[model samples]
Target chain A: MGEVIVITSGKGGVGKTTSTANIGTGMAMMGKKVALIDTDIGLRNLDVVMGLENRIVYNLVDVVENNCRIKQALIKDKRYPNLYLLPSAQTKDKTAVTPEQMKKLTSELRNEFDYILLDCPAGIEQGFKNAIAGADRALVVTTPEVSAVRDADRIIGLLEANDINKTHLIVNRLRADMVKEGNMMSSDDVVEILAIDLIGIVPDDEHIVISANNGEPLAGSDCQAGQAYMNISKRILGENVPYLDLEVTKTFFQRFASIFKR
Target chain B: MGFLSNWFKSSESSSDIAKSRLKLAITSDRAVCSPELMEQMKNDIIKVISKYVDIDTKGLDIKVTRTELDDESGTVNAVLASIPIKDKRPFRG
Candidate 1:
């Protein structure tokens, strides 16, 4: 059976949708059948982020509403044969789908795909509850900013309260240079504060924005952020991939440590 | 003047400040009582304790913080009560 994982953040614009797309694509490339579900309903942007917006003839609401089959609502990604997207309806609000329906839907999906990733909406509302209702694991995405980290902490508390015992963290859009200068928080800082297992740390890359705008996920590529997502996918697949050297711009400890290894 | 001002300024960067602040915030969130509630409890404890003994109110520190009681529920907030005495009383062993 496929594991159901939800990507969430307490605050908006922390790259939950982007991380969902890239991780889904990376897993598919690794020969795992993956389905990306956009659960944001009214503010659906996962389709746009995945560059599958133009092909959405049906959406999540259609599947839940029984207007269309789940297979029909799923949009296959051209880049990766195993990767598919279940887009959310633009016209319907979050109330269009209920937590019970989501639970049932994900259970059905668990039988078909190796990974069922839910792109959760920001904030701890009905949308968040529905997204996590059927999830066995959670990945809380956050930036290096105080607000993002604070929201991530809040989400971790909520996830623990809900009995989602398996929770990991993804720190995205990390600028190494700023971290070195002490202008921004480091991955260590975030992980230390959140006290959750660190799944991946993605660097700040211009290609991420470019790929999002162009409807392409940069996974399985040389893009730093994309490579980070790929590494996270491998880790999720039970691979012991060592973390990337994304300790912000400062390599003081790393450099100091490497000197001894050499 | 420059040396004194530099000495007064802490070496903690903004990121350090953020980590410390977030740690405090999350601890409070997990705590059962709010800041005001903790404050009231502290005052009440002080009032009751001062009925028999002279204590240093300014030096006294009490907070509703985490306690290492149960390993599993270590995050559960608990009260830390400490009161300093102003004078010592003679005792016979």
Candidate 2:
């Protein structure tokens, strides 16, 4: 059976959708049969982010209502053959699906795929509850800002209250230069505040926005954030992959000089 | 006028900026203390404590500190408030 992991955050615009697409793609690239589900319902954007909006005929509602089979609603990724997406129903609200329904759907999907990634909606509402129903673990994504950390802390408390203990942190939109200048919080600071195990730190790369717009995850290319996502996917698969050192920035000559000095 | 000016200058002593706003907010959130009620309680505390002891009214500090009561349990927490009293006794030779 495949593991079900939900990518969630309490605050909006923290790149939960982007992380979902990238991490799903990363896991697929590792030869895992992965299915990404958008649980945002009315605010569905994972289909557009994954660049499969045009291909989505049936959605999660259709599958749950038995209007279409689960396999029929699954959209295979063009870039990675192993990756698939279950788009959310834009016309329906979060109340259209219950947590029990989500659990049933995921349990069935778990038997067929190696990984089922649920892209959760922002806020600790009904949508959030349904998103985490059948998940074996959770990935709480947040930025280095105080507000994001505050929301992330609240989400962690809620998750713990719900008895979801297997949760990890992913600090996204990190700006190393701002952190170095003491203008923004560092990954270490965020981890300390949130009090969770760090899984990944995606840098504030403009390429990510552009790539998402183009329906191509930066993780498919040689971007730093992309590399971080790949590393996160490996770690999720129980690999002892070391975290990328994002604090240090070195030019080619500086790297060579450091190598010689060492 | 000069004495009043000196008094005012002395009253404006530099102190460390309060860096515990977030901590205070978190404590109050956990404790379910409304901001208005918290202010009133602080004033009442100052009024009650002043009757017995002299406090540095400007330097008066009343903050809620949370500590884990135990390691085995997850919901273990305690809130404590610290209020320092000024030394009012005259120096003895």
Candidate 3:
């Protein structure tokens, strides 16, 4: 059976869609049958982020509304095998789907896939609720900003309230320079505040924007952010992978001295 | 010398301020109890404990936190009260 994991952040533009795309693609590369479902309803973007928008004929609403079979609604990825995407209905709003309907669809999906990642919409509204309804676990993504961390804390509380106790934290877009200057929070700081298991920390990289616009997530790429996402996927697969040294971009002397200190 | 000073300043990062503020905020947010309620409870605790010995109420810190239960089933919301002392002697009866 598969586990349905919801990627949510109460604040918008916190990289929930990007994380969903990259992590799902990484998991599929490990030979695990993975599926990414965009539950953002009218504000669908995961299909485009994964560069599969042109192929989406039927969407989540079609599957739940009986317009098509679940298999018919699934769009196979062109790049990665054992990976699929279930696009959201761009015409209808979040109210078009309910938590109960999501539960039904994911329950059916569990039998076929190893991991089903739900790309949740922002806020604590109906869209967020519907995305998490079928989820057994949650990955709360947040940037190091105070506002994003505050909202992520609230989302974690809400997930636990709904009996989804197995929640993890993904601190996204961390800038080492800002953190060194005391202008940004470190990943350790976020973990201490949110009090959840640390799953991954994706650095703030320009490649993310470039890849997203080109309809590709940073999966399997050799960039720093791509490597982090790959590490997170391995952790999800029960492999205890240590985090990469994000502070590796230091001056040559600093990097050399650190080896002796350790 | 200016560059060296800048590097030292980063060690005392403003993250300390954020950590303290967030800790207080999340304690209130847990809804185990409100901040006002926790203040009242802390006062009452000091009053009760003070009958036995002198306490430094100003230094007392009481907050609601989550603690894992021994049974490993789930967590339980708990109140942690740390009261500093001013003197060791008991109050006169």
Share of the reference A-B contacts seen in candidate 3: 0.39
- Pairs of residues at least 3 apart in sequence or in different chains that clash in candidate 1: A51-A215, A176-A248, A176-A249, A180-A250
lDDT of 1 by residue, A1-262 (tens): 9999999999999999999999999899999999999999888899988888889899999999999999999999978888899999999888899999999999999999999999999999999999999999999999988889988988987887788979999999988867875678999999988878899999989999999989889897886888899999999999999877765443789767644543
Report the first chain's TM-score for all candidates: 0.93, 0.94, 0.94
- Cα RMSD, model 3: 4.4
Every candidate's DockQ is 0.34, 0.07, 0.34
Residue-wise lDDT of candidate 2 within A132-173, one digit each (tens)? 989989999999776677788778777876888889999998
lDDT for each residue of candidate 1 in B37-87, tens digit (9 for 90 to 100): 878888889889887787899999777654445666435456776799776
In candidate 3, what are the lDDT values of residues A194-253, reduced to their tens digit? 878999999998999999999988877899899999999999889999987887467899
TM-score of each: 0.85, 0.78, 0.86
Which stretches of candidate 2 lie above 4 Å from their native place? A247-262, B1-24, B32-77, B80-93
Locate the minimum summed-lDDT window of 10 residues in model 1 chain A.
A253-262
Tens digit per residue, CA lDDT, model 2, B14-79: 211111343344455555456687688889988998877777788765654334346734543343
Worst 10 residues of 3 chain B by lDDT: B1-10
Minimal lDDT window, size 10, model 3 chain A:
A253-262
Identify the runs in model 3 with alpha carbons over 4 angstroms from their true place.
A250-262, B1-11, B34-60, B70-73, B83-87, B91-93
